[model samples]
Target: MSTQYEALKNADLYSTAFRVEPPTELGERKMTPRRPGFFITRSLSGATDAERAALKTATASQAEAPAANQAPDGSAPAPAAEPASTSRLLVPAQWGLVPHWVKSASDGKLRATKLVHVKSDNVGTSTAFRDAWLNNQRCIVPMQAFITDDYRSGGKPKPTRIARVDGLPMGVAGIWARWQDEDGSELLSYAIITINANAHGLMNRYQAPGSEKSMPAILNEGAYDAWLGSSAAKAKEFLRAYPAQKLLANPVEKGRKNPLGI
Candidate 1:
């Protein structure tokens, strides 16, 4: 699995590419496992039933004596100006998947580092990610590029950065989950989905020599909203590998570490 990636440094890209305004301050440019990163999810902007009940009670009281430009009738809870169903939330989440069954924070951290990438085929049946997948907690991970290792040099692996050929951002398919401790503290995390790229013209060259090749499940720009709203059964349709020809890879400089993640 590709364990490292580069975040979008420009905040405007989040708005232009994902249609959500990012935080004025972004996180680290290079995001490894356990780092904080942003994700895109569907946002439902409507009042809760309890809030609607309170409005109903107050509106009834005012109806007894009408005023010149009275407020909207409380019979309908949603306001006309409410956001559309396609509204999205740009959420910041850790770069790992923390299942709700994780008993302690220490155990969760240890597992987070290893859960950075999930195979698309096994995500639905994997014990660690099954719940999140079935619950339809899908997300779009917006990033500038993902880092991998090219072993073609026959020596130490060279760190490679894979990005779109058009120089635009990519929205990778991912799943998100929320874990809560007994004290009510919460941790939100996510994992990027990967697919077999062994036959891919470009991605097949990366990773190790004998191992199965894999690349991230990058989605099309028009499918972001559909991916988030799709049901568990239909979500798998979006896990196909991105066209290898549309991606460009280049060597990125980093510290002396195991870029191959052996």
Candidate 2:
């Protein structure tokens, strides 16, 4: 399975100019999303200036005019010039998953109110996530890298960044949902999946001593195919970890938490 150690390699390292691509870094091994804590890129939001022009230019291929009585599929609404895919909205959410069952935003529990992540282990059983998982609501989270904890050194805190050895972008297994508020405002939400850690990496070095029980399950390009592909069995394979050696980890600075969640 994928661990935060591998995720950081995709990150911009203050230590050096080294970069990595997820596929080349992990070799041809099987991978999964992280189990617990994992990294996410939030600072980037909305469409870029160039993307707007591209959206307009490519509108013919991306958008489609919808029927009068039907709702536009959020992924690719009518007037195809605009991308019909939800990748734009999926890139950054409010940093949580809000199930459709919640009557109102306030009706959500603390867990759903501020959902940071969703474990693959609980995907099939979680009432909030099961529907999305069974449906084609799965997505891939793109990130340059990620951070993790290491508490094995007797209490001294150590933060680490994990990234791909190659410079290409990597995708983490994710699930997304579309929710409309009481006032008719609609928003998208998503959660990254996680798994367990491996030896000889940042996760092994930084995770709390004896408390190193979990890591994010990462899906590489190949595993990503099965995950996003049509086969339910193949998608299930994505729930496991890729190998460990493909990952490399290094120490990083722990920044203050984001107030609004990027």
Candidate 3:
């Protein structure tokens, strides 16, 4: 999943920016999202000078007037009942999907027990994800882009970057939880939600026909309400894939996985 900053950028919000170190791989290179327009060479361990400045501004803004979840679009919504926090939590890619019941890092073993990918086939079932699904643990993973696989049948490996066609960044579906280490330090983790491939989309290009080894669970603007709102029923409906044409895939400079940049 992309970072919150990436999602905001995709939504056309430029003033705010968040930074973090991304993982080395995402299942396959073809599953990678496109390179974001903006990137900083700084490491993810500490905030860069630019990130520190941005954090100061964001912190001040939040302190001045905390958001009330007015709308899922990050805007003030009309009068309604209390709003669920639209606040997003950004964590390291290494820690993905920490279970709520975990008492310690050892307890977090279940993190690996469950598949990182959330399958659409078992929407209401799937013990692996049923709890998170019920508790509305869903979230948007802000990402610059993702890597995808193009398994060359009887050939070599093929990869591609699946980016937003509208020239925007994206926020993919994610589930998160908190875990504590032996020293009592709290840590957060998240996992990207994925779906099966459709007719002939990017998933199909590399994935064999009728393959379930591809595609991320992308939410559309209209469905953002149900997703962020945590309306399990409606969110399930929105989990359906958007038209393949809605996404744009392109070939990127191939080499070792290093810092992300244009």
Candidate 4:
């Protein structure tokens, strides 16, 4: 293995305690509901087709369950019962984007763990992301909020949670790829696209006091279709910082807890 790859293999930069708070109704965001398979770190495998279909139905049912169980007079139905399973509209996926051509499982695993974020400026040329970017293999990573290090305190950067002021899910730009092993098992992975945020009032304060400012490429509501279908040149134009006025941030205590529970 090359020295750079070896260093990445030794470091556990892929592990993140941050949890994305996905919206309850994905349709409200006008996102395409394609059933793309994704891998979660704990699960380590993609969901089967059957599982994906079932999840879709379960999500819809949960949304209408309240009205379905109500009476015409706005009263609760008799004989209260528990749901079969709690539906989760939001999916938890591994953060890294692994290329399809990795030679071995071990090598793929190492790269996937380390390649969590791809810089927007280099997406078209970086060896790690060029293929996916050139092929328009784009994806939307929806999240209500994400955690980052804030350095305004001047001493040491502190962990801060950032979310949209409107409390809607943020559609972060991303790229995905699939890797199949010799046995035919497959792993689908993704990485968030980030861009320079040095000029933004909100994002510029996120990193260490003087370090370069960076933020995820958050897409606007009407830009979803364009992002997934537009030419590479058009897509590149959308990879910019979200408006500072629309964001909110607060300090957070260090822990693995997901503030927005499923």
- Best-performing candidate as measured by TM-score: 1
TM-score of every candidate: 0.81, 0.59, 0.60, 0.65
RMSD of 1: 11.5
Per-residue alpha-carbon lDDT of candidate 3 for residues 138-237, written as tens digits (9 for 90 to 100)? 6656555665655565465444566667655455665644445668565544556667665545556755434545567765533333565656676665
Tens digits of lDDT, candidate 1, 1-262: 6798888968877665665645668877878899999777764124345435544443343334212221122222321221222456677789999998999999999999999989999999999999989988888998888888899989988889898887888889998888889998888899999999998888999999999999889877656666888899898887777777678987766664644222
Q: What value of lDDT does candidate 3 attain over all alpha carbons? A: 0.47
Could you tell me the TM-score of candidate 2? 0.59
lDDT sort, best first: 1, 4, 2, 3
- When summed lDDT is taken over every stretch of 10 residues in candidate 3, the lowest stretch is 35-44
For candidate 2, the per-residue lDDT at 47 reads 42
Misplaced by over 4 Å in model 4 are 1-93, 253-262
- Worst 10-residue lDDT window, candidate 1: 65-74
Candidate 4: C-alpha lDDT: 0.56
Clashing pairs in 1: none
- Candidate of highest lDDT: 1
TM-score of 3: 0.60
lDDT of 2: 0.47
Return whichever of 2 and 4 wins on lDDT.
Answer: 4
What lDDT does the true structure give each of the candidates? 0.77, 0.47, 0.47, 0.56
